[model samples]
Target chain A: MAATTLRSVTTYDLKLAAPLALGFLVFFVTPLVILLALSFQADPQGSRYGLTQYVHFLADRFSLGVLGSTLWLGVKVTALTLLLGYPVAWLHQRAPGWGKGVIMLLVLLPLLTSVVVRTFAWVVILGRQGIINAALGGLGLIDAPLKLLYTDSGVVMALAQVQMPLMVLPLITALSRIDPNLADASSVLGAGHWRTFRKVTLPLSLPGIIAGCLLTYAAAITAFITQSLIGGGQMLFMPMYIYQQASTLQNWPFAAAISIIFLAAVLVVVSVFTVLGRLSRGYTNA
Target chain B: MLLTRRNLMQTALTLGAMHAFPGLTWAQARPLVFATFTGSWEEAHKAVLVPAFRKATGNADMVLDPMLSVDQIAKVTAAKNNPPIDVMLHDPGPALQAVAQGLVEPYPVEKSAYYKDLIPAAQEPTGPAPFFQVVGLTYNPETVKTPPTSWADLWKPEFKGRVGITNLNSTLGTGFMVELAKMHGGSESNIDPAFKAIEALRPSLAAVAANPGQLATLFQQGQIDISPGNFNAIQILKARGVPVEFVAPKEGAIAFKTTIHIVKNSPNKELAFKLIEAALSPEVQATLMEEPYLIVPTNTKVAMKGEIAKALAKDHAEIASKFVFQDWAKINEQRAAWIERFNREIRV
Candidate 1:
């Protein structure tokens, strides 16, 4: 009799969950499913419904080049941010009293401001008559101004500035979590401070590095407005291409196809990172 | 150097290749939807057309949809099998693209009535489709002290960083250039010098806007003291007592007569056609002109000798003498290639 009551309760729970699952299918699952279906479609006026649209986007030489550059920048941004962000994170970790407050403010400033506002600031700094050139010219430092605004270097610089907050926060968390005794143990055993840090602290902090790199790379690849305003006609990224296809051209299938391609690319990157981390023997409980 | 006044149509001319979704037929009673854009078009749609359309139809429920040009295109194309919009106020190129691709059906406008009321250049002597009304350079007189009397005045170094112009691919920008070319030893016949001169004036161009409104806002702010503009913003400025004017400079900004067409597979084809008829009617067109004189209707009976029209055509006599409208259909075919090359080579 008690077992029967338990079975009835289990059935009641699933009955309630059925509607929620259906709702999920209706709202979230439907659009994604439709997009997947349409990604394959191609018609004369637009995509009708086939693998043709995806094939068309993939087949283009221009799109392939854009894909290559986009993927490269994603990796570059991730690596560069880790290099810059790790030091700031360490400073924040080792900071004392008043130093901690200042470091916290510095880290959070970029997060508090709007992305568009921050990007516009970069524009003024990077433009032809902007601050850097003015200072250089005023000092009689150079004859000609540097072409800094629209180049690939400009893209990376702005991207790094925007993504520093993401990289630093995770790393700081990881570094602070390290046990003080592990360092003392190495020193007690007559290991020098540098050796102890190299053998212990550095290896321990890498998981945070991986996590920060993952977040930064994902954010950088998806950045649209910053690249759009600065790049203009000069540089073309994946998001911009998707915007043009979806908005300017009104090719839904093409946009969907490109988005699917981008999603696949990201998954592969994430999978590779996971594999590499596993190979490094990250079998730690903490 | 195909010296046309606009970009080549990037929209592919692939017609009737797929069957579209016919959601709700016009035979059924559903309110017709008109896709309106932001700024002048939005104001006109809201204040003028919607009310008139509702009163005329007596439904009091005419639907107005707001989307950017590209978004609207996406919506229309996304719902290609089943279209939501019946009527559109789209640019000529997209309209032409739609017509060629069979997204829109031929709107049986009386060729004689449309052509007779319009400047000759707007007639589609060659292309499969002709859509979009032509708009040109309108400016504010209070701000433009020794105002631009011709296209040539815009190139002066005095207005450097004080002048606003649209991107080259836009109809008005293309029109402005064609006018300059005609005056500076290029013509509908020869356009090389015009390209050369435009390249020279790139240094003087303060900003390149996507449309005239951005240009107008900059002009109003004193960031830009002069602009090569369209008819709508000048009228809005004059309404607000901003001392704006529209010049016909000897090379008149190219004028193309516009049209409204039905999408072939639209579920709302019947209501769409009726709504279009109302949009193009004497009442609605006149209403649009009342606040911000956006369009001088193709209807000859509108009798546009009003205070607004006179104020808008600031230097009418001078512009009338020199105005030369380009043949748009012929130019539309070659515009994309020329614009691409100009952007690539001459934007130094």
Candidate 2:
């Protein structure tokens, strides 16, 4: 038994884990570690390095404000998604037996298509010569074209539309887990329908909502191609700013510093989500 | 653990034997990484440019790394320590901006071969720094019944809302703005007047875009009445069944002669410069400019089949007189501040 325990894991291991682990270390971890390391170094001319790179990021007012913008967009997108998603999820839960299959297919359709194609569809619909503009123009709602494509409202609407499905799926799963008989019992016990929802359904579904919010916020904050394509180079959120730094400006240290700051903000958002989860008793850590 | 002990020893022996007799290895060891901006330009580079270069240089295992100019700049800057791209095709702003950032190294010229063949204006640095290509205004003839007689024609009420402008954040758009401002008697040093002028013309603008294809689409649909295009973009649009014509606008489009400098941080500078040397060659320069990807060549005499070079040459003298040569050396650093101000002032 002692000899068996003493044997090298490499000598006895039967899987290909070691080689794949090595590949991940070389490909993913090394690049990230290098970037993390370089973010700290200062490059005044962008030709050489010191610790001033971080100092520069810290020193710049815009870089500091990037957090607020990112968080504001994230929270707004999440909240809007939740408001729009809950009803759709409720509908899914309350669907008739025959309608269930069709609704299920409908709910999954947007997920099957590419985000870019969907966004382009929105662009055409929202464009000057597009459907909405044409319809609005015909109705004499506004004299001039309502500037819809490149506004904050446009960004939020588009973002929420894309994220609503993510919010709904998890919510439907959570809602499905709640026993309908429990709600019936609560109502029979003299609780109103609204009261039953407040007391049971909302509380029970909080886990999925929190998980979904975290996922949406994480995905929304890091968006690049979507924002670049749709933002019209005007409504630059933190991700767009970071991308311009990393890409357009070609300042890796500055870009990495911005990313590091963003990463820290994401960590705080996650921690807050965890705290919310724990306080509500809606999530299990395991 | 899976392999027998004998097999392991045999593997080691084979590896050792291969290492010992290196001359016996017939396989080429290096990967040819050629990068260019994405879209039709990339397709052309892949279809014709890279293949021709490979055939000429005898490099067969070449890989194309198609990316946006921004992405290419990032790679060149990030991999400043060691670059993946052996050759790259970039615009004037990025190429000049790279030089300003010290990401580019001076390209040594072969006096007789390069100096004698390059156009007088394109042969030397146009600004405080050197550039890779001379950029100017190009419009399609098929779209214009009466071709724009002057640079100021873009602002005429007839072309209102049919003109596609680029994003102000980009060098291309900013360059266009600066040129327009100069036509209206303002300078890049005071870009405010230019911005105000552009704002006044916003009603006439179709869209502020970067994609050449978007402009092409507008032209194809007859939505774009006029386009302020790059010399190559005009050529690309014409090839795609778009009724387009190019002009050297009356006040003359700005002339930005570009240079092909070796990226300072590239790992394979020796091979890169050889490619650069090929780029400098009159034969290659002429080929790049006169064919499917019709860029204006810097070389004085490459060979223009018939009307191609002459068409490119039309209005050359007129556009040259009033051309605004941008001072990238100073402006490159101030670009961020200019862009910030532009963002604050420009309507979203």
Candidate 3:
């Protein structure tokens, strides 16, 4: 019993993580608790404490619409990133050793540049007389420029590009971990490339897909700079909405309430992904 | 001399404590931090104002911590007892907000050497306006053959899909809305006409930029031909070889007074007053009004010249006649509701 109870070499003492835990408590948890308390105030002046701010947000159609649209934007961006990122991940996995390095560098290239720079590049690309419109106009495809810069499609496209690295890297890790012999074995049993991919390769990469989607989804929603820059002022997301309330209006209680609501909404989505990840783990093991 | 482990530990802790709590060292006073706006404002102040301030104060140690007006208010409000900023710069809207929040000290009018030399509009007991930000019609000279003379020209069919404006989160945006409302028979309390005017401008709108800064980029990209833009911002863009020109609309140029104040509980209050005094000086104001900066001066003694005289107004009397200063106190009262309404309504 003593032999069995002896500490294993692989296990670390809980005391080793005490400093980090203490830091998290002081910085992160303490601030969050304060924010939660602040949100209960009825007014910016904190004259009364109640659920007025929450009610004010939840009851308002405009506020709910902003929240809905922000969440929907995340869904659209995550979907686009996954759709575009999956092929690159697959290609990376299938590449030769040197080709793998080249593909990795290309995948990681966007991450090196700042998000603001990337967003601005998107602005230049999506403008009325921008590269796309210029190319189209030169080819005599259209007489007038298409409105792309401030549109929903413009925001989705930009966000997808900015967050592409998050989706692709995780996918590459998952795809590389799959056994090369399994695909060969599936083919030997008379399955086609698409069939083998759907059955064997696809299921194996589900965990990575879930993780990538989670990261991209969360990032695309809270990305204040990219959302504001590419999405334009007219397009109000949760981040901008919070900023408007907090900074512009100085309604701290309302801003805090909105942020807490946004946080709760994000957590709900993350939990759904977490459950899927657990199921994917079981499926991959089986 | 032995360098014992116990002695080494004591030395390390002493150093750490001194680093953490800097007040333990009583020999040094903290640098007098002046929170100014970023970009060209910082550049202009660093080049002209800082040098002038140092010269006046016998080479006093000061730092220019550039940030937005709201951020300055927040930092000062967070530590009211011991404010980090000795001085703060604010637009008309935030200047009132700061005063209401009791974040700033009232200007010592009796003590100031140059306060009486300023224009009547520049004199405020809370904080004195050292500079004016003029908002006028900014258009691409290359694209716009005939320069826009009125704000109403934005709604004209000829400018279809060639105009840009910002949402009402910025001073420029809010001021523009107030101007529009006034043009359409509405006052500061009544913003309904402005919303109606903006509705009419929907057909002509190309991009509603996130901020005034984005408007410059939009002009560069040829995404927008015309918009109501700040004079200084337009000058900066034009200096960078962008085909943009500033013109005072026939109605009037919107003037926003950028006020400077000492933080309420500032330890460097004396130095802060000295710096503000330097800002209000004709020498500093005149230099700032010159090329590259193009910042409008509030000091009547400065005598507006060069680009400011050419583009904005000829003299202080002309400035009074041509520039329309809005009631920011009234605007600030219902700005929150207006912002909410704009969020709900404005979309192109």
List DockQ for all candidates.
0.13, 0.23, 0.84
Model 2, stretches more than 4 Å misplaced?
A: A1-37, A45-67, A96-98, A138-144, A282-286, B1-28, B73-82, B97-108, B111-115, B121-164, B180-227, B234-248, B255-292, B303-312, B315-325
Ranking by TM-score: 3, 2, 1
Q: Candidate 2: TM-score?
A: 0.78
Judged by DockQ cut-offs, is candidate 3 incorrect, acceptable, medium or high?
Answer: high
Can you write out model 1's per-residue Cα lDDT over B1-348, one digit (the tens) per residue? 674434333212221211132233223444577776666667667887677666766663567787655555556766887678766655654555555556676665563233334333333432221222445556556656765766777777787655566655456666666666677877654567777876777777555554455565445444456777666556677678765677655445555444455666765665665666566566666665454445655443344546435633433342244345465555556565455445445432
| Per-model TM-score on C-alpha atoms | 0.66, 0.78, 0.96
Q: State model 3's lDDT.
A: 0.94
Q: Report the C-alpha lDDT of model 2 over A1-286, residue by residue, as the tens digit.
A: 6786686756756565988888999998998898787687665345556667777767777666656776887788888988988888888889998776677787789889898887777677666666877899899997877656656666777888876778888888888888899899999999998999888788888888888888888877676655555556545567777766666566677778878778888999899998997876633322
Instruction: Report the Cα interface RMSD of each model, rounded to 1 decimal.
Output: 5.4, 3.5, 0.9
> How much does candidate 1 score in TM-score?
0.66
Evaluated at residue A284, the lDDT of candidate 3 is 95
Model 3 residue A115 distance off true place after TM-score fit, in angstroms: 0.6
State the lDDT of candidate 3 residue by residue for B107-167, as single tens digits. Answer: 9999999999999999999999999999999999999998889999898788998999999
In each prediction, how many residue pairs overlap at the backbone (N, C-alpha, C within less than 3 A)? 15, 14, 0
B1-348 per-residue lDDT for model 2 (tens digits): 689999999999987877777445554334556676666556655765566657666875667788766676667766777677766655566766665666665655543245555555555331111123334555546556788877567778887766766565566666777776666677766666777777787777665553444555445544456766766666666777767776666555555654444566554556555555556566665666556766555555565453344554533342245455676655566666666655545543
Expressed as tens digits, the lDDT of each residue in A65-132 for candidate 1 is 77878888888878889889888988887899789789979999999999988887877777656788
Give all candidates' CA lDDT scores. 0.65, 0.66, 0.94
Q: Candidates 1 and 2: which is better by TM-score?
A: 2
Q: Please provide TM-scores computed only on chain A for all of the candidate models, following their numbering.
A: 0.86, 0.86, 0.97
TM-score of chain B of each: 0.75, 0.78, 0.94
DockQ of 2: 0.23
